[model samples]
Target: MPHSVTDTTTPASHPTASDTSGRTDALHSVPTGLYIDGVWRESSDASTIAVENPATGRTLLDIASATPTDGAAALDAAVAAADDWARTSPRHRGEILRRAFDLLTERAEHFATLITLEMGKPLAQARGEVAYGAEFFRWYSEESVRIDGRWSTSPDGKSRLMTMRQPVGPTLMITPWNFPLAMGTRKIGPAIAAGCTMVIKPASQTPLTMLALADLMTEVGVPAGVLNVIPTRTSGAVMTPLITDPRLRKLTFTGSTPVGKDLIRQSAEQVLRVSMELGGNAPFLVFEDADIEAAVDGAMLAKMRNMGEACTAANRFLVHQSVADDFAALLAQKMTAERLGAGIDDGVTVGPLIDDKQRRKVAELVTDAVDRGADLTVGGERIDGPGYFYTPTVLTNVQPGSAVLREEIFGPVAPIATFTDDDDAIARANDTEYGLAAYAFTASTARTIKVAESLDFGMIGINQGIISNAAAPFGGMKHSGFGREGGPEGIAEYVETKYIGINPLDATVRNSHTDAR
Candidate 1:
């Protein structure tokens, strides 16, 4: 059975009621200023940005938006802190990460609440987000100590060849609004674990969780200037300069493909090492022999997660002709039963979209697809609620080349299409340019292995929808973006490799003038 965040109870050692209240009050009332060099400083001027809880459409708090000057200060702090953090022993780094992880776990619920309020994910799901967020810190904590440099001996034992990994200096991490905690943690975790300092520019919509995380990191004894969190203006005021800064060695981001490409282009001038996990329009394939119950369960589970705002959500459902009708029928039935409301509501299974823009985009996609002759079996209308709520919609017989199938619809609209044969299914699945994740459901072992190999995706799910784990490298192929974000390969994204070799009197060294072909 899969573990759930709701299965556990808060321990006695957890923060007391008064402490919890105090933290919440502090989060709401305190200045949401730039956290640079272990201090909260105003963002140069009176430029303030208000953060809202998407669940209730209520104003949560207002924070100072980091201006160009603030961004520069953050970059400067990161550079100044990088050398000392890099020189610190790996074991000590691991300890710092471990303690930070413990602190995160202790305040998991409080942090989850922040995500629910700011990001509009259900409270239960928000807890799960925090759990996933904590896993990064825990995984990279041990990984920091395991960053081993290799050595090779010469034939005469008179010389040695050595290779080592070094932090790529100060990093600038720009996170998206969806999955606020996870996005920030994924980038910041590996960079910090590799002993690299960083400045984070969280999305303007959901900055509270990242801000709270920064406070927790500082509380856990992370050195001054090691991590700086700033809520920035949406006009790209501070963003443009952060990525273009010469001192910023690495730029990590999780966002749309267009913005990601633009950032890559801007950073390319300085040859900045870029690591991105961009948008994905993952395909969900259901073969004839698949376990219908399991496939249906997986589809609903994938769609409702974060209100289907995730990059790896099963966007295009490519079903075999034989079972296409059945899959669609069952999926629509399951989705229709899901209750939609606020995140704090215990009975509500699906919450609102992050904001008005996301809601409008989702609504437009559904309308466009329906206008193109697709059948909306379940929800097709936005629920009238206080927040940015959208009904979980299931569409069947969606035509190929429809807007829903071609574009990344980051919402709870499941588009279904039928295929006749394996070749046809594979061809149709590969039709899209986006290839972050692909799914295939099958009971036949042979078909499972074959389809898994044939799919052109970074991550594939066979007989299961769950694809993320601490041990597995997670990323995508094609426009879904480049680089990875998990496992041992994750920390490598923040490091550069160097090799050294020495020759002695007892060893034969190749002559510089000698030519060997």
Candidate 2:
């Protein structure tokens, strides 16, 4: 998956550290060493990764990468902090989490700018992700204090049973590049709230947002060793050692399905707890009774958000045959008209792909579909510019078994397929191994419910484009992966239940006390 880098295009000159675009200040603030045990230090052997700006293909910063020795130190820090963090009162944890939420809000604009600079997301959407990211801290703050257990009588009436929820202990969170700030907060909020200490490893492509988040949490009173952030260029130097350590109680990942499965096998060596939000190939279904106008509006955000880099982004469009022509027309118009430029530029709605390789992958899929008879409604070409830009694409007359429908098309390409009825649409939608998210549009209330229930996905959105929030559990199904990352249930992923049974001595054994009574 690695590719050759060529910085052929010169980066645009911008304002220095005082500029509000925030990249200058943000880049200056990136710690020179790994943040471990609440302090910064260099890794053994001294290796670093060059952080790049996807929009301009410019080297933004050279961050010191974590080595195996550094990762071992981080794991040790978490292990040392686990017991005290677990023993800390839930109310205290909740208060700190809420404080972190407030701090994130206060610095929202800066971090959002950092997100845009690193990952090529438009500024507006980057701010939106900042808001979404902060919500987890707020939601899990309340969730931390609300976690409860129960007591019950045994069947024999001679013993009492009680169940208590305990922290899963030290954990490791491996987040993806697509949502740097949100992914870290999504896992960190619950891990800290559930009294678990953790080490965070954000994707090297986008680690600044995470580094900024770690800074904010430390400033908000997260204790030393309770949280750690380590970024490494090579996985074997860090991942293998950490995943194999028995002391690491849990490891949650948000990445590709193949990598997730590999992590599962690695975690099996220790039988540790794991939560994976992996790859997805979602289907956006539009029925005959649906409002074509409304569905088109939904389609714009559903498929083009983050330039369609999200795992939950609608990958396949299954439109009812009756309204296929109208839906395709409106969708194609909106997609082709979207403005693409640098993420920092004002009014730019669509940005570049993460890299040239990703852009080429998207291009390959589009080429395959076109050769297979899929009509190129609009935008089947790459934008000619300095940035790694690809025009938002829409396609119809899609053939069966095409790569767009079969694989996770993590780009701005929408392949439209027609179905005659509900059964056909449902079958078409459920034909993939990925089942992370599915969407549907219908006027009938009964049909809406029926389609929502019938879709084989972890989450279904009917007449809605945005479904993820801190108040709802977000994860995947089947090859899309398992375990939830948000809502009340999200905190539960970091907890373990223990049942204790108590028995009372027979009354006859205490004759002296009984006589006195």
Q: In model 1, which runs have C-alpha deviations exceeding 4 angstroms?
A: 1-31, 154-159, 508-517
lDDT of 2 by residue, 1-517 (tens): 0012223223333324423243455566666578999998877778888888897678777777998899999999999999999999999999999999999999888898889888999999999999999999999999998888998877656778899999999999999999999999989999889999999899999988888888889999999999999999997569989999989999999999999999999999999999999999999999999989999999888999999999999999999999999999999889867887777767778888999999999999999999999999888787665668888889999999788889888899999999999999999899988899999989999998888888889999999887898999998789998899999889889999999987766622334655795
| Model 2 lDDT at residue 362 | 97
Query: Candidate 2: misplaced stretches above 4 Å?
Result: 1-23, 506-517
State the lDDT at 143 in candidate 1.
Answer: 95
TM-score for each of the candidates? 0.92, 0.94
Evaluated with TM-score, which candidate comes out highest?
A: 2
lDDT of 1 by residue, 305-401 (tens): 8889999899999999899888998998888788777665566688888888889999999999899999989888876546787888889889876
Best by the lDDT measure: 2
- For candidate 1, the TM-score is 0.92
Tell me the whole-model lDDT of each prediction, alpha carbons only: 0.83, 0.88
| RMSD (CA, Å), each prediction | 5.7, 4.5
